[model samples]
Target: MSEKVTVLVAGSWGTALASVLADNGLQVTVWARSEEQVAEMNQQHTNTKYLPDAVLSTQITATSDLAAAMDGTKAVVIVAPSKAMRQVCSDLKPYYHPDMLCIHATKGFETKTLKRMSTVISEELGCLESDVVVLSGPSHAEEVVKRLPTTVVVASHNAKAAAAAQSLFMNEDYFRVYTNLDLVGVELAGALKNIIALGAGMVDGLGFGDNAKAALLTRGLAEMVRVGSEMGANPLTFSGLAGIGDLMVTASSQHSRNWRAGYMLGQGKSLDEVMASMNMVVEGIRTTEAARDISLKYNVQMPIAEQLYHVLFEQSDPRTAVETLMGRNPKNEMEVMKLETWQQWHS
Candidate 1:
């Protein structure tokens, strides 16, 4: 028998995951933030506003009331935007059970504290490290909802919690789940990739070819690993599905809001203009700040992340940032390998 799970997803990704779980025979209750979204899910059995074409199964219930939606849930998957996670979880905490295996699918750090999604979940829900989990990978909601083959990683300090989440989402058909014990590495990898995805999008928008994109992604991976290591994450996690896998998807896929935002910037659109046109919150905008702060805090050198930060926040000219990056003194790629080795040997 399939275990029933309750999911809290206020956006398209959450809706998409709920759809996948329901399709796999797990009963799910999704908390829709808006009355309109709730109505569409409950009455129409479809999220017309966000997921217009896909039909949500009747087994998944959508509700506006927080307590009502969370009642009797076996486990919880929180999929709201990172910026909104604190408030949402705070509101739900009165009803959140300590025994619940709380899993987060949202990627991006909390700007004020620079806390990763799992950390935020830990704070808001008052849960111990063992109770928190994160699931991430190179997944796009538009693709995942369509039953496209997608693989994701589930990470937790406690293997039991990770296994619980692994069992909930794994299947032979459209979705697959891999497990990891590095929660910090997984969450940092998930958050940091958005910044690189922005960089990749800029390259594409500037009409740079595959060669340029390949270079950007490669360096981007190095930068992500560098900063993540500084933050005490396992460097090997960067080579896994949560790291390289997510970087590839967010950087190249059209379904990525961060990639699209960076592409618009590359095309010379002002940040305000690009933001005005986007219906969903592009996490890259906030992540750029967190990554920049993390670099300074850890004394890590992340030229690409820093440059993209300037482009996004400081209003640095995209063309100029690109020029500056290319003009930097040429160095051997061995620096990256050396740093990785040092991290492993030192710690």
Candidate 2:
């Protein structure tokens, strides 16, 4: 018998990941909050609101009942949106067992606590924080559902847990999974990059040229590394698949909700209007607020995120935010890069 895995929620990313596990010959059950959505997935094998164009795998199943979804599953993959993670995990506590391999593909922080998704999951499930593997990278759900050669990383402090996650998702032809031990870095990089992606989209919406977008991506990455390192992440992870690679894809892709939200804001739509127009949750909007709080908590300088916070919440004009970024006190480009040089010379 094929191993059973249950994926929480039937959003685009969740549904897409469930398909990957199904393709790997696992009996995958996807839990959705809506009975109507569950009916559609089982009857038509389609989640039209999310993954509209792609047909789902036959090995995949759907249920609105959480307990039914958890029944006999060997692994539980939590892919609920960040805002809903705590409630979802709390609800799953009755069904979650210690022996089950726990993994999360969610990529944003808890707004209330500024906690990572893995932390939230671990607390709700009463499991070790290090035992929760985070799955993230440049892999977009739309592309992944089409089997377009997506690659992602699974990070956990426990090497065994990371390898277990890797084995469950890896496919030679189109889907690939790599393991990394830098759980903090991977989680931080994944969440923080969405903020930069939002800024990237704003640049495009403002009719800015490629040079502007390039600068945003580069500098945005510096901000990510700075905040991530302060939060105990490995600085090198910022240069890897979960960091720069994910940033590139999210900033450039049409599939990103955060980018779309930022683009609309740049085009002069109100935050309320942009959010109302979006059917999906734009993680970066909330994440920007969380990053702002994090910056203040850690005393890290995150000018872009700070500017975005004002633009998003304080009603600051997007153009003025850009100006503020440009007019900041000039600094050397190699400040972050030449740390080793400075240390060696001093030694």
CA lDDT of every candidate: 0.87, 0.92
Summarize candidate 2's per-residue lDDT along 180-199 as a digit string, tens digits: 99999999999999999999
User: Model 2: residues >4 Å from true position, as ranges?
Assistant: 337-347
What lDDT does model 1 reach? 0.87
On residues 290-321, what C-alpha lDDT tens digit does candidate 1 reach at each position?
Answer: 88888888788889988988898889999899
Indicate the TM-score of model 2: 0.97
RMSD of candidate 1 to the truth, in angstroms, is 1.7
Best by lDDT: 2
Q: Write down the TM-score of every candidate.
A: 0.96, 0.97
